[model samples]
Target: MATLSYNPSKLRNHKPQSHKPISSLSKPIKIPFSSSQFSTLYPSKFSKLRLNSVSESSVSLPTNQPPLTSASENNFNEDEEVDDDPTSEVSYLDSETDPENIIEWELDFCSRPILDIRGKKVWELVVCDGTLSLQFTKKDSIFQVANADNYNKGLQELGIKPVPSKRCLSLLLWLEERYETVYMRHPGFQVGAKPLLALDNPFPMDLPENLIGEKWAFVQLPFSAVQEEVSSLEERFAFGASLDLDLLGIEIDDKTLIPGIAVASSRAKPLAAWMNGLEVCSLEADLAKASLVLSVGISTRYVYATYKKSVATTQEAEAWEEAKKTCGGLHFLAIQENLDSDDCVGFWLLLDLPPPPV
Candidate 1:
């Protein structure tokens, strides 16, 4: 038999076979690897590995395979998971139960109209807001008084009938009695042409039974008495308070009954402007004669005055000094006459009564 000799150059010159397109493949190709080899290579356990053909965009994951999570993520606490959830409802019971969250309601006063039984004009009193609406009759009183003709004329312009002077007087008396109940416990009254009214009740409807019975009273004073008695009382008393009475336009001879609200001295102004027609020199002279030592208290609504009573005791003097330190001291000092006396007069002289002991 004759053996055919093949040259290496002939094989090199031969054309190679063409490959088929991957899109023509019927199924995904398998990646051949042993379990031990995979463990050694990747340090992870995976079964039945598959690879997509070149024509496919992505590989299909096995349904039985667990998602790959990092060690840090796997170790996360359960609380953190709950916090991460946006829909989680947080409890605020701790904050709600805190004592700091509790707030005391404060009383605020305003002015309102007083209508008679016939819904006509009754002389308007500077009363608390809710009080008039609650206490006054809705109907207008038939009795008309001639004394308030000017007032009645003004009311007639507004289409309101005038209330009789007799009826008006009766209503005033009744209102005073009613207000006494409301203000008896309170320290003083705030009096002015336009005073604040109580639009809403300061106390909650569900307040404790004991608190419901608590009452406040108004300290009614005449403008003249305030002017005369205030200086004398300050001279005699160790304690005094400041108030803002500039809006009142109180004249020396005017018989305006100014109501003062009871408030802590701290709330009072350090100095106030003197009401219209008040003589500064006379007031200063009065204050100087008494050698008055003034100390402001908690509220500015009323000033407390008491006679010095044979010189202040050592303890009382010390206490007055301390109060002066705490409450910004008296508006006027006997030695400090050249200072702003008008400001001192306006702010410090609310009333001429001695304050109750702290």
Candidate 2:
């Protein structure tokens, strides 16, 4: 306590301790952080560096690894790849060996005869590989043969041998059958390989008095009569007699047959006009008054006309018999008599009439 009494002079002589301002300080000291602490504090920057490193490593990796094989590829060997080459002859053999790859030989036959835009005959056959197109006229040498034996002989004369393959032979037979059927049935050849007559040519007029009336008469011969040449159409039309008339050419059932001629009477002007406009050879004649329809049936290749009258009197039967007798001589026959009936009596007549000229 006695030694501390003289401190006032020393305190008075000592200046206040100097203090530095905050702005005058140099760079601040940094504290080192642990990995977890750095990541938590600056997650985006850490993540970016980590992504860049991974990308660099991936880009530097080698890319020469083998390609993966598919299930279909695994089914066949590497040698099978060579067989798919189309240019190689081995591919053909490969196709022949594998039933799945084999192309089946086919012939797509046409049911109806084909015609061109100009109505010229055109034959078509679709083979397995492609189409076989052909056109021939009745004047062709191949058509001159009357029967199969003659046809084969003609082919032999032409140095064309029968095809070796049985399948091909069958196809040829089918073709021949089609050709014969077409030759027989086609309208162009229906009149025994003769050219079709012009429409303007007047039909034969000198028929029997019974068959010919003031309004109507039989005109053309039946298709069968023309083909078989049973009697000349000219003679039949000029002089009527009991000639063989057949409806065999019509491709329809006999039981449901109703064949008749539609007469253009003075009252049937509208119908005539319509028929003329249509330019058709045959038409349904239910509306016409002068039409005579007869129920027809095939009796031994001959078409017989039948009539059913309400009153079966002797006179009526005799008249019917006379009408039938008149029709018997000519192929296309129509009676002048009319019946009393309220029902519609006309339907389609599937006669082998020629189509109107183009």
Candidate 3:
């Protein structure tokens, strides 16, 4: 219950004046979250701690000792009444973090020192030798409810089918990750939670886990807000023994796979590993739009039936006859467009990481 600044009085009177940030919002439903919340810069923000001090030194995702609902959770809900859309019936765990009863926790999560002290919700997953922490920032909307049910249906539809863990991770990201802070359980990289903006020197990343904060605290997040949080993230993928050595932004912890229901496709898909030869479907005739990082993530099952692009389509061969003739005209070589078909559309690309060493 400590903080860099404990201004209970300021928090009580604070009311946001500008509506610009909420401009992109369509239908304009008002979701009154706390005044001083954190980042919305990246659709999803993630950082891990790699603890060297724990008894069993290991590479794990952010973790919390089991049963995460904290007891001080209940009274916050009773202190204030939150207004929302009448049509929105999403329910969340009944817990609150009212300013009148706020206890300031340190701003630092990992190596980063955050000033905001808002409530966050998280899901804990157990992986190989570590624990995975999926933290989120919540938002309110009917769109979130639809997104949640869609993700739920996706998991169930693929009941027995084996999907890659990476795909599953992507699906969750595409659903929601509204503006908020995110941290891992075991602190995979070990260093404290450093703000994504604090990268000035080469990462001396090897450090201790400093993400300790209130654990097992329950907060009632409207279902819509919860879904918004899930969608705003960018799922990360890392495999191979050398994943840790790269210093590239990819540190690790996650997975899930999905399949194309309409067509058979093992057709090669673009991958994060393809950084050396990063290719986009169309050239950016407009630099601002094409060059800009459009947010992308894997949702459990996104049914893009109308826009399916299979790289494995042999039908393309018939169309590439002219390029083939030119290669033959040179007498030494034959021409052909890409014979391999792996649609790159489904790939959820992460931009922050340094590409793997050439």
Candidate 4:
């Protein structure tokens, strides 16, 4: 996670305003985690596993750690989403002839449904784009398996920090497609051996007590107002989330009111500093849990607020859903003084996007 600091003295006062209701808005929908008839896909652990391969002899995960499981967290820069056009949800490379022109890639380096010359399982590298329109494949026997230590070391070698972002929807969907059309056709394929992978997010953790602000409130501000304030802030640990709003058929404008949580604390600086280290993604109103879940780093959720502090009603859920669509799924976390203060200590602009498809 990257950090930015700005003087709070330069902030502008925003008057309290009623959030405009979005009429005829679509109802809230959960991220499609289950096949319509096959129940949930991969289990919890498999959702975060990358399909890399290593020699059986080189596998050395700690005794307590799961073998060959590590979320390859990427430090997705804010610029990946077009900064100039807030309405533009995706950014693409300029080359049409370069081949593999998509900015992000989905990969699967794992055992196939076939055997090699030595009667060993065949391994291959499968690549595809989000839409599944493009495909590339390579047959290989060995590659570096991804694990926590290997991921951290790779980032360290590149002189960069790890900031996990969204899950790889392309690879996930590809897995499901293969399971349905390809893998199941093999005579030796066993359902028990190759379990279905799921997109179940990890349980939310408790926030550090000290990081809780003195006061916080659910607020709504105009899109222009929120964007302007974030821009005016001198210091910010920011991430502009990439969204596929076109897929969702959501639209927005300057007057669109975005929903967010505003935290005011005497220890605002320290609070912002602590959050800066976490890859804060989006805030969700979990109706089933009746909790406000803060999604950060790859698949890590935190209990931002419980029902006791902030009730989760259908109306609230619908409001959040509407706001998310209208604003291209952009939600914010504003760390500042009391609700009335004009100055912002730290600001974060975030968006929640659905898992990619292939």
Candidate 5:
């Protein structure tokens, strides 16, 4: 969006927005989400809106947390803090008693813009727990999900805090079903549907020789800038592809600088265009192999950069470590003509979400 230009100099004087710190949270690990969730994960028309507007809003962990109604929710006391630690050991002996035995549920809050009965636009929140239970049944006047206060207050009334992130899986499925079984049958609703890219194998393919960049460097950018820049990206961009950074169990503010890698090349545009075709995932380091890897199309992997493991490459390893600790393994790959140029040819936000639990 906006002709892919990044001014590195701006970061020097950049003052990040004020928000809750990641360390302030009671727990630091996200509840483990299921790999099966990927099958239903698709970007709807509301994706870009959510990503641009409330991407930084407080979110609940998706994994190992149960959705509680007024009656069953009594298990969690008001004084006892609910810990949705993703690293906890799970025993399958009792699903009801074992926190780890519970599967992660997807939630979507107010991200979908829909028309109400009076033709007024409204945002709705859909919360589904591990058992596929719905918390708030009244869809007539659901609270606006963007305001974090409204979200938490509604949950607090029901004895829940930091409600789960509404990733909008249920809404996506309903829309898809409606389009196929209902809408397609009608002439007026026969318009093109939103493009969907399902997660493939996590492995990434090596870039074609011609698509390789002339130079690359590890760099950082403000989360707000990334969110702001993507809004203007044309139809050729992958705006909806993202992993729950909340999965990192850390809340990042708009001003938080996101660490990533930048590539400068004469063929930047084409390189970016090619990536648009694949489901680009995350950038990671293979310390044992002394190589930088890019994960795309689900399980597919690619060798982005390789170096000898020695004192010379020590900084490379350190960058990877710091990024993992700071951003929940989230990173980026930006293709540009040169390091100094403000205009970027392509930018891809990469996330290193944890693998599914066994």
Candidate 6:
């Protein structure tokens, strides 16, 4: 079958803030020699796609780890009016709940398309291609957004693909385990700014009956992957997410649920970049496990090695001695300017790691 071409006139242009324009797939896709192995519409530069076929078979996951699935709750969609103020009896955050055996996290996410325009039915051929798209309404914007669609097939052609919204939480974990890169997606996420899941980031295993959007958690992820919550303007270069449940691929029942860390961040770059410009953060710790300190956050959790005594000093030799002694596992200490909130080149705490056990 002949591949469909993209429409040069309908493409949108975008200014990608911190991401690179993808020219092709990161890796070459192995096309199945057997035609029945896969079903896909070969879309070219033309902005047209049609389903070639539909086959029913259980999708074999790429990895052994499967996506999370939760048993449906009766009230998942039910809405009941409650007292707005927490001082009332309906307050969940105020009620008694176990503080331990819980995980909490707060993270900041940003998402914006380089180019955008709405798409509609063209001669009744318009159909949602099981994926999203960013329609370009102008000539220049199409160049900015997806001019490559004229010849390329799929988002990889335009350097765009729908990132799964739910799996980002899990993917963040995977990135930590796989790549050494510390930062998340490119900076473009900040362009169209809004706060979606600050409160929703924390989980409530042993939580109050009336929990509000306060940043609360037993353990928050230090750094983890997440899908940016956004408005309903779905597009090709659009955002992705994980299906809501235990996004971390953890077991969640009445007794066990894992939560992630999330924080509301300011759109403006300033004294602080994340969590709405709140620079100084406090974290809880386990006094028993003093040697290994864990930082809990919304997306991922991290551990820091600690010594028997507090080690803060201006003397270069003393600082080196302390770091060397503490880091039995590391071969060398790469110490930047000692901890400071304004330190542009070092670790900035979204939630400060709790003091090591005495």
Model 2 poorest 10 in a row by lDDT:
45-54
Stretches of candidate 1 off by over 4 Å are 1-114, 124-177, 180-348, 351-358
For all predicted structures, in order, the TM-scores are 0.17, 0.18, 0.18, 0.52, 0.43, 0.17
Q: RMSD in angstroms, candidate 2?
A: 48.4
- Give the distance in Å from residue 309's predicted Cα in candidate 4 to where it truly belongs: 8.4
User: Tens-digit lDDT track for model 5 on 195-295?
Assistant: 32332344546756755666665556666666544543554353234433332233566655566666666767777777666667677766677667776
lDDT of the structure predicted as candidate 3: 0.21
User: Which should have the higher TM-score, number 2 or number 5?
Assistant: 5
Residue 227, candidate 5: C-alpha displacement in angstroms: 2.2
The sequence of per-residue lDDT tens digits that candidate 2 reaches over residues 1-358 is 0000112223112111111221111122121212221110111111110000112112111244223222243353333322221111110111113333424332322222433233444333323211111111111112222434564576589675543221221223234443453434433332322222223333222322222222332112223322222233233232111221221112212111122332312333333233222212222211122223332111011111122223222233333223223332122332212211111111122232222111
- C-alpha lDDT of candidate 6 relative to the true structure: 0.20
Off by over 4 Å in 6: 1-54, 57-284, 294-303, 307-336, 339-344, 348-358
Q: How far does residue 104 in candidate 2 sit from its true spot (Å)?
A: 40
lDDT tens digits, residue span 2-59, model 4: 1112223433656322221211112232322111211223322222223332233322
TM-score rank, highest first?
A: 4, 5, 3, 2, 1, 6
Checking candidate 4 for backbone clashes, the offending pairs are 4-236, 5-235, 6-234, 6-235, 41-197, 41-198, 42-196, 42-197, 42-198
Which scores higher on lDDT, 2 or 5? 5
RMSD of 4: 13.5
> Candidate 3 lDDT, tens digit per residue, 165-194?
221222133121211222222222223434
Each candidate's lDDT (Cα)? 0.24, 0.24, 0.21, 0.50, 0.44, 0.20
Residue range 4-107, candidate 1, lDDT tens digits: 11122331121111111211111211222122211111111111111111111111123353432222334523233222211111111111133334231111
RMSD after CA superposition, every candidate: 44.5, 48.4, 25.1, 13.5, 19.8, 26.5
